[model samples]
Target: MTRPDPADLHPWIAGYLTPYTGRTRQNATQYLRRWETWCGQRGTSIEDATRTDIEAWRAHLSARGVRARGIGAALSPVRGLYLWAAQSYLITHDPAHLVRMPRRPTRSQRPWLDRHQLRRLLDYVDHAGDPAMRAAVHLWSLCGLRPAEPRQLLISDLGTYEGRMSIGLSYRKAGGADRLTVSPPVEAAIRAAVAGRGRGPVLYNENTGTALSKAIARLRLIRILDAARVPHVTPYGLRAGFITLSLEAGVPERDVMYAAGHSSSAQTAYYDRMRHTIRARAVHELTDWLDLTGTPGVTPMSDVPATLPP
Candidate 1:
């Protein structure tokens, strides 16, 4: 299929994306262009697209082995395009509105570091010669940043919010601007990483002295874990560990959800259920019950709810 000319697409795309950020506008344009290419193959344009056409296009992509999430991403812009066009009176109906994308598959709990593994990883980063790597590790282990989040930080993004050190986050996968509050140690590492650079991205390619690529960040994590003699884990595992450790240490579920940018309590609870500390505490309570009464009938002390403070 021939690609649609940008000259023909630019005017409509510009108006549709006026409210989006630069990055979002770029993504929307890419997604829409892919749709346009599909339409071109079928001898139609998006302006004449129908619900059936959209559904067939979705099926075509699925037949090509596109994952459910990718199908959703591709369709979202087409939906937006029709909505914008309908609102502008360029089209009488929004065909893309009723077109359904595939349901996202449920994700299982991902792997993460335990206390001993995390401690060793942090120790290695702390002693490493590179300031940028130190900041990257601390952001992962302490502040619970997504891998891409740390790499996207700019010098101007650092600030004080409510008397706590905060990092402005603009590149969240879920979208929207947000902030991450950090402890003094993490803040210090961030400052050290940005030292001698007053602007632009904070995380840098150690060799290129430019913003670190996502691929490079993942590879870097593997090397860092190997050097520290810790077992292999994903950068996402660092984030999961942060949430797990925080909940296990009795941080409120709501607070953990907010800090970790989780959209719901259910997601936060999922991490809580996976924390090893909860099992350890339960085992200790059972041991104590057995030692005290030599009875199998006694409930573990951990099963009792704590009294509220007056």
Candidate 2:
């Protein structure tokens, strides 16, 4: 019996996955390419794959310093390709299904900047060399806008209605257009930053006058953080701080969800947990109650007088 050529499979897979070309296809292609390389080194074809072969491959990946999540992601395309081949009657069974993915550890709650740190960071941005960078940081800190969303913003997006400045966010991931009423301070910052620049991307490279990339934004943020000597702060951390501060200020969760462009209320819940304001407020109230009861010197519950006669 002759073996099928793996080179012939690329066009078929690409054609089948034409609808998923952007990031998803790119990731899948990377995983598939790695699998092909592995299989070539072993002198095996997809049709000749077996469960034992998959287990050995998993071990090989683990030995190569692949983390559990990376291992899972690497195997995902293999599973999909096997299923596709099975569905097309090119293979008798899907060997990829026999490969068990390692369990990934649960991630801890995300971190957000506290109110004091947030204020300091914004002040630092204000004093930064680039005015556009200052405005961009201000928007992210104040409005909880995603990094990429602000990059695509235009001057026309900022509109004034009933003496209130509002910004329209059209390309949101939440599948609808939403508008945020810019705070007076933020609007002033943006106007001052873009004073001479005509309608285009609001956030642009200081040197090139072109729209900023995520890498450039990240590098600029690192420079700002290093110069200010602020530790553990990222651009996303500023956005998280905006959400946390809003929740602490008694803003309703649904309203925060809208402003943050969160796809679900669960994401808002995560932000609430990170805020820690509710816990702090509860402790404050408890301390106040203890103080009002004339228990300042009390050590523990055992020190309290029992209401029942002893």
Top candidate when judged by lDDT against the true structure: 1
Candidate 1 off by > 4 Å: 1-11, 108-110, 160-164, 170-179, 195-200, 229-231, 262-310
- On the 0 to 100 scale, the lDDT of residue 167 in model 2 is 86
Residue-by-residue lDDT tens digits, candidate 2, 146-251: 7777777888788887788888888676666888888877887788777778777777676787877788888888888777666666667778778878988889
What candidate 2 gets wrong by more than 4 Å, as runs, is 1-29, 42-111, 156-170, 173-179, 270-310
Question: Which residue window of length 10 is worst by lDDT in model 1?
Answer: 1-10
Model 2 TM-score is: 0.68
Taking all chains together, each candidate's TM-score versus the true structure is 0.72, 0.68
The collision pairs in model 1 are none
